[model samples]
Target: MSKPVLTIFYQFNPWDSSIGGIQTVIRSFIKYAPDEFVVRVVGTGAPGSALGVWKWTEYAGKAIQFMPVIAVGEDNVRKLIPTTIAYGASLMRHNFASDFMHFHRIEPTLASLNWAGDKTLFIHNDIRKQMDRNLGGKAILWQQFPKVYFALEKLLISQFEQVYSCNSESAQHYREAYPELAPRVAFLKNGFDPESFYPDKREEREIKRRELAQELGLPETVRFLLFAGRLHPQKDPVLGIQAIAALADPQVHLLIAGAGELEEQVRREIQALNLGDRVTLLGAVNSDRLAQLYRAASAFLLSSVYEGLPVTVLEALACGTPVVTTDCGETPKLLSPDSGVVCKERTAEAIADALRRVLANPDLYSSEACVRTVQPYSAPSIVQEVYRQMLHRWQYRKAIAISSPYPS
Candidate 1:
């Protein structure tokens, strides 16, 4: 039999310039997609770009078709429903059909409105919590019609075939909040390309560390605590800076990588706190460079106020760098005595205390042990599981569709 067609509404550009944890996960999926299905991705171009033929774009060395829809608004609250319909319209001419559909970082109802009900919505963050936090607090629920948007979110979750939560915390949240929809929920943690982020040899790691120190005009002896993610309120980059300032040890330096709306605020805080000498803002390095930064770090730190499984933490663990992160998402599931520390709370004091504790005993987090902790989450394994989960759920749909031959 021919492989089942698996059309995905992936929500972002698959181009090399794309950034963020979601983009990282999508790229990995495209790279090691199971042979059980043929794939097609439908997504959007950067905001304000013109809408045109974006289909037939090559990604991860695969010549898969990609439909890049351009929408007018930034919030995407008003545009999502129409945007998905338009993309589906574009694909219909090509006789694009699938056994099932996939939606990532989105509430699938709108996008999958014109398609099959056999959908898998991958929850990347707590959307409801983010919205409650609001724009000032940096939650993304700024809709022209708040009530309608929320209603749509609710409808999508209740109607989709499955919800693959990005972490156990997310899975548990969904279960407790929406008991009726709990049966379809499951954890699907983020992963890394082990080959790219693997641990370096002893001498190699040190040499790269010293080289990076020289590049940043810092001493080779200074140990780094790396923080990579958006400088948004949700990621809590400001909290990370505050924690850095609160640390008692002068050798515990922080390397910030990423650009976001709060760049100006982050700069002002660093200046006000007089952390100029200790905090280095590298500002969004590429994947290869990020891997090097992971090796150079004494430990990785994420002070996110909320998260769904952070890809940065996954990469750090895969790179064999111990983590000292806030108690959020999959930290408890992923961390170990051999891997690194988890702060008891989100307070700057607690973060500083955790940093000091890790700094004092660096040997407790060896390269091998850190790598060993994340072996199960390699890209190949994660992709295979995704296939298995989707395939298992799609079986029910096939049984009905073969007899009905109906449209979504």
Candidate 2:
């Protein structure tokens, strides 16, 4: 018998490791897939005037096809409409010849409404909550559309054979939204690459911290409160700066490692708040550099208005750095008093208070304790379970196809 082929879809440059947590999870799935399965990855790229060809690539030493659809857009929201149409058109034109299709996020799933085969959806965030929080600016113009759009999206959700959420909180939310399909929803938490993120020795960490300060042009005595995510409305980069301003601690600095549409706005806020010396935007850094930042930082800060289980939180914990985040996603459940702090509110004051508690007693949240907290979420272990589940589903489908009296 041939190995079951699994086509994984995500509407972004999947090869770009710096994109965010979603890419990390996708890469993990590809990297740790079992020998009995063949996984193919599909992503979007600039329009090449014609459809691009599938190129076989070696990812984590496994041979797989890297297919790109010629669909381009400027930003996340803008990319949705074009990517959705492009994916639907691509599916219509090409036969992936796979036993199963796994989609990340809503757009691709929306495009696959006509697919009658074994398919699954990965929910990375609380969709309803995220839409509600991000419905501002020009989004207010089409405010009524989301109500009807998501109503249709709910119907789309019912079409999937299985749905995996990044956190239990989001899993529960989706279950409540679609009561009849509640049994199909499951929580599959995110994990960090243990090889890429881990605690550095005390002597080595101090040396790296000094080197980082010299590279970023900061004082040798400065302590970093790192924020690593896209500077979008979802992450609320401005809130992080506000929290830093509220802290009013000269020895502490906020280092933002990612950039997005809010870049100019973030710069303006830094200047307006007179936090130029206290805040540094490093733009986007690769996985190695990010791991170093996690090692050197005093604490990882996340001020998002909402989230699913954020991979940054897991990476920070894996790197032996405690996280100080607003109460969102699975932070409250994932973090313990000794490992990290979960803020009671989303306000700057609340975040500042949490930072104060972590910064004041650094020894209380020991590196060993922090690392211990996320050991259960090791990539190898988590991805193994993911592959096992996929194989089981594939086997069940095969059994049905073999026993059925009618053609599949």
> Highest lDDT, which number?
2
lDDT of 2 by residue, 266-296 (tens): 9999999999999999887878889999999
lDDT of 1 by residue, 246-277 (tens): 89567668999887667888999999999988
TM-score of each: 0.85, 0.91
* Poorly placed runs, candidate 1 (over 4 Å): 46-54, 71-97, 127-136, 142-150, 176-180, 389-408
Tell me how candidate 2 scores on lDDT.
0.81
* Candidate 1 displacement at residue 297 in angstroms: 0.8
Q: Model 2: which ten-residue window has the lowest total lDDT?
A: 135-144
Query: Whose TM-score is greatest here?
Result: 2
